[model samples]
Target: MGSAAPAFYGRRVPLFFNPLEAAAHRLSIAPPMFDYFNTLGLHALVAAARLRVFDALRERPSTADGLATTLTIDPRTAEVLLRVLAGLGYLRVKGGRYRLTRTSRTWFTTDSPTSLVAGLEFWERTACVIWPRLAEAVRDGSPVTPFYELLESDAALSRSFQAWTAALARRQAPATARIIPVPRDGGHVLDVGGSHGLFSVELLHRHPGLRATVLDLPQALEAAADHPRLTLRAGSFLDDDLGEGYDVALLFNIVHGLDDQEVAKLFARVAAALNPGGAIVIGDQFRDSLMPGRASRTLLDLLDLNYRVATGGRVRDFREVARMLRAAGFDRPRHRRPLRSVVTELAVAVVKSPSRP
Candidate 1:
């Protein structure tokens, strides 16, 4: 059967087909479905390991009954879930005993430095809940999603979120540090929303003279406490005072989460903080509709809806960001396309002189 569905009652139905045809039809729509599947997949994989199924298997391949007793699950249900996971390649079965596959060994190993277990935990614990409200976010024009509001009210949830955010920065910090220029001649850096102080750590490692002030919620300081080169301050970017006279300030992935008015205020603050001849870098997925041969950027416009709903923030297009920079009293914006995703554009705005407030 062809992948395309036939029409019925003003809507196409894939279930009308035979079992093989229905499976093929489902595979045809798997691209969009994969987004939904990714939520459960990563987390489930983590949860299984957390429940000690892998460790149980590590000692020796075990029958489902053995795994169930060790993992505290019912034998019959554990058998079903195990077989499904084995089919999905997380495990393998031989002689009626289940074993962890190589795919599980690489990332699922607790000792692996590059393990994605934290990433999976963040998804299972949060993103899965937030994504269901995408349509509501699109309709409401509000950046704060129900998930964020929930976080504000729930202290435990908020802490989990902060931890996940910090983990993400820590994991990606080395890569970011490699790309960002660290001045050897001695200059301070302002790490805007500097979660975990990864940026500061990486920068200071590269340049001995660089000191950084990480401006974020005080709760975020938990991740930054050990970094000698970083000083953590607690305050909102809009309401808090950003200290004056820095040579280079970084607004990495910060602008995308705020509205135009909020971004304008932030720019004005950043401009005030910079010394004359200083530079401000706005690193984010700056939307570029014209980029040739790249569909990922275009697709990100859809993914950004999650940010909009959950945090009261909106991702910016390149043009929108440039205009905001100019309005905040900066010279023309300079942009660098560092990655294929629209999220990775680094827009640097130069502060030539202090503007009269």
Candidate 2:
């Protein structure tokens, strides 16, 4: 009787053959669902960060109830989130307690020098909202919400954006300083669109004789660190008059946000700002230069899409940049020696003569 056949809609079916169970088995054996549900993971991570769950774990390993009491969340929900994070490798469970993993301890903790909390906050606040409009941007041939316009409208978001970029810049500046040469005779260095001024600061440290001026929007300068050798000028690099007689100039991570004409104009401006034989370094992710099947290439490709949706910017290859530099009256552009930590390639050009206005 236990192995008897069952009737399903007037048809005899084997008792062991359950349609729902078979369907579930098929779905489980299909390709992993993680890829399809990646957004869920990202949102969970963002929520955990915002709730300071990692910070709580940093103090001591705790069970879900302990976390709930500490963070003022429901125990069941806390348990679910902790379990998800543990699966994501940011946390681990041992002895009935959830603890931050090494990766989370270093990056999620507020006190850590390399902490990414600010960056994550900015992403959660701004980028997450903007990314959903990528399709609209593609359809309209421009960003639905312009990056600068978004920053200008929201003061709090603007500050977070600055801090977020500054954190990344601080990490990259040391490697950037190593690749680019600074003038030995205490020449002026102009940093165009230098939001946080960390790159200028790093260069100043490497070349003690160098004095640098950072030119960017006033709001962007709010988070920049002050140094005796560094002067912060608050204005748009495109609209503002860049003071002349600079020996070296940097345009790090900026060109992708401009059109071809704008890049040429920017190069012309840099050329004019430089003294004869002064060097101009353009640092950006050149799509053509990236190797195939590499993680950096994929990262840059996504970043290129981001710029397209956010700023009407298109990431160009090194050849395209070189063409623009030449049109602006600079000498042939050459790739600077690669730095380990700097994924963006550096292209250098020199002013032999003043660029025609």
Candidate 3:
């Protein structure tokens, strides 16, 4: 018999095996690389831009020394920052002079409509700090809670939290508009933890028959009084009693930021508020076996970790959520894929029989 090669080194015979399977296995197990590279470049860009490096460059393409003179920075430090930007494909260097690359021209211009500078500034000031506590959060349970604890004395931090929450709602409003379902008739829709009523506004716009009630912190509500079509209520889910007789209740990106007990209480509350045959729609990231391309639970797991540390909450699996729904009086839960990123799962549960209630 011929000598056998080690398993680590594929033999000539093994070469005939399927390459696709091998590639798939490798990809499945490999860690995400260059993860910090983009963030590093962003930080550098923000720092350099704040120092007026981009403004100086726009004025004229000059050597590092001349650029430093204009910006009032050390020539070596300016050159280093310029090189970083070049490596990130934002700038180009030739013969010791620099100019904005084509990629930067469109975005870096002062009056460009697509400027992401403000968003970048927001991330640098807030998100960056919160991300580091993700591990600690995962072990504890709430991403923002722990962060708030750390910055409890800082009033600005508290304001930033609310601001970012609204900003995030606005950013995803378009995407959420596409996925969320609107009732055929003027059915009542309850928005749990929805900020600024953006999703409600979209729901109303998309489905003329749909009326919505947005439940959020008192300060988060944009409108006063529950209108004939649209209503905004101010109260915490834990303390306030949920109004009854909702045809559809929406929990968007809310449950994941809560622990099991809190989630149980929320589902129970939602069940109590739901009318007969009414459905509860949950929108969030979940671990799904069927939806491969649509799932990003792993990337979101980091966010889960942050939530854990910050709020004492966690993202639950589909089965876990289903069980919670069932315990809260839901019948068989149904899943839907109306959009990407936001998984829409519905559970129709009985609150109480007419004989009992």
Q: What C-alpha lDDT values do all the predictions have?
A: 0.68, 0.79, 0.63
Question: Candidate 1, clashing residue pairs?
Answer: 143-312, 144-312, 145-309, 257-313, 284-343, 285-342, 285-343
The residue ranges of model 2 lying beyond 4 angstroms of the native Cα positions read 1-36, 126-128, 291-295
Model 2, clash count?
A: 0
On TM-score, the leading prediction is: 2
Error of 1 at 34 (Å): 6.5
Which has the higher lDDT value, candidate number 2 or candidate number 3? 2
lDDT of 2 by residue, 1-357 (tens): 111221111221111335664455455643334333455767788788889999999998999999999999989988999888887678888988998888788777777766777777567754569888878988888876668767877778888778777766766788878877677778999999898898899899888889999998877888888999999999887777887999999998899988777787888988998998898988887877785644456567778888888877888988888888888878968976466655667999888797646
RMSD to truth, every model = 6.4, 9.7, 9.3
Q: Which candidate is the best by lDDT?
A: 2
Q: Give all TM-scores, in the order shown.
A: 0.75, 0.86, 0.64
Candidate 1 local lDDT, 159-220, one digit each (tens): 65665555555555665666665566878898888756666777788888888888876555
